[model samples]
Target chain A: SAVISQKPSRDICQRGTSLTIQCQVDSQVTMMFWYRQQPGQSLTLIATANQGSEATYESGFVIDKFPISRPNLTFSTLTVSNMSPEDSSIYLCSVVSFGEAFFGQGTRLTVV
Target chain B: AQTVTQSQPEMSVQEAETVTLSCTYDTSESDYYLFWYKQPPSRQMILVIRQEAYKQQNATENRFSVNFQKAAKSFSLKISDSQLGDAAMYFCAYGGSGSARQLTFGSGTQLTVLP
Candidate 1:
């Protein structure tokens, strides 16, 4: 198991503003992923952040809306751009290694 | 495409009693992994238990145990001596070995532990 942490646990941002959530892991990992959990809904995968390359977004998501950066193995960031009221949800980062994936203390973003 | 399902939207149980959360998944592959995660009001997702499809014996951890019915594609979690802390949203997840290690989570079941 890996200890994962996210910065700015909760934030209130105005519509049209962008917020970048940071995820830090205790050790190097091969794959990092981003997920969104809307109020009273199940989680949906946003993208897979791979170090040194662009992320692979899920079917309903796009890179322009959720830009991701995985500069290294132990850290990654997901920025929700041009936020809107519909974008209000908890953003989580996950890491997978040795067939096990762990989640961070999600970032609760409230867009007003 | 793989999908996980938690049919029960919410469940309630009295403290010190036992409760079971049901989960079923659809998959074409033979080998995979199943997991149950607990999310409290604090909203932190915590791993409760896991089971590997290839393993015939069920997996158990403390008060948490799983009934893995491979042929039925069912993975249910049983909490013994349920505590108030067990009140939360529980999510069922599925992941396969190899490069396809991404987890597919089910709609959560909110468990309410009453005193």
Candidate 2:
């Protein structure tokens, strides 16, 4: 099992500003996933970050809005840029190791 | 593309009783994995159980169990001796093998444990 820690557990951001959420794992992992959960909605995959390459984003999400950086095997960062009220949601980081997936506590962002 | 569906939006069960949460998925691949995750008010997603499509026997963990029907592409979770802590939002997920292991999540089912 892997333990993950996400920074800025909860944040309130102003519109047009950007907030970067950091995810650090206790051990090295190959694939890291980013997800977004709107209020009263299911989670949607934002992107998949692997070390030494660009992240693969899902449909309806663009890097211009959510840029990801995976500098190493154990760490990654996701930046929510040009935030809006609609961007107010919970962001989660997940890692797959040994065939099992684990998730971080998640960051709750409220854009005003 | 694979999709998961959870028909139940909300359900209530008395303490020490049993409750079942329904989940079904659509996938073209023959081999895949299904999972049931629990999210409490803390917002942490905890994996409650998992079942591989090839496995004929159902998977069980403590008080939680699954009824995985491969032909029907259905995986339902049954919780016995329900406790107050069991109250939370339950999500069903489906994922493929190796390079195709991206998870597709269901809408979710909000469970209330009545005292």
Candidate 3:
């Protein structure tokens, strides 16, 4: 089992500003996943952060828009750069432990 | 790419009754996993149950069970003896076999347990 802690459970940000969400896992993992859940929508994969290498983003997401940093095996951060109202959503980090996927308490970001 | 589809947008069940949420997926991978997750008002996603494609027998966890029809690509979750605490948004997800097993989620179904 994995216990994940996410900071700033919810935050209101001004448009054009950036907010970085942090995720700390209980144990070290080889790869971590980042997801975005827009209002009234299902979760979508933003990127996969692998320690010692760059993060791999999904088709609609790009590095510039959502830069991720995996400084170590147990920690990762996702930054939503130049936020917009459309970017207001819940951000969740996930990892696989014992073949089960565990998620952090999502960070709800509201961009004004 | 794998896609999960939950046809039911909303469902209600009387307390102590049963409810089933529908889910269908499209994936070419023969080896994969199916999951049902419950997200409450707190936005914490809790894994309700899981089923493996290789398992022919259905997967059950206390009041939660799945009717997994691999050939039909359908996996439905049945919640028995529903309680008020069961009210939440239920999401069906598909995770193919891999290291990370990146998940593809369905739209979601809001389950309301009526007293």
Q: What is the alpha-carbon interface RMSD for each candidate?
A: 1.5, 1.9, 1.3
TM-score, candidate number 3: 0.98
- Cα-based TM-score, every candidate: 0.98, 0.98, 0.98
**Clash pairs, model 2 backbone:** none
Model 2 bad stretches (over 4 Å) = none
| TM-score of candidate 2's A chain against the true A chain | 0.98
Give me the runs in candidate 3 sitting further than 4 Å from their true place. none
Residue-level lDDT of model 2, residues B27-73, one tens digit each, is 99998788999999999999999888888999999999999999999
List A-chain TM-scores for all predictions: 0.97, 0.98, 0.98
Query: What's the best-to-worst order under lDDT?
Result: 3, 2, 1
> What fraction of the native alpha-carbon contacts across the interface, defined at 8 angstroms, is recovered by model 1?
0.59
Q: Order the candidates by DockQ, highest first — what do you get?
A: 3, 1, 2
Candidate 1 pairs with clashing backbones: none
The window of 10 residues in a row where model 3 chain B has the poorest summed lDDT is B95-104
- DockQ: which is higher, 1 or 3? 3
TM-score: model 1 vs. ground truth: 0.98
Model 1's lDDT to the true fold? 0.92
Candidate 1 docking class = medium
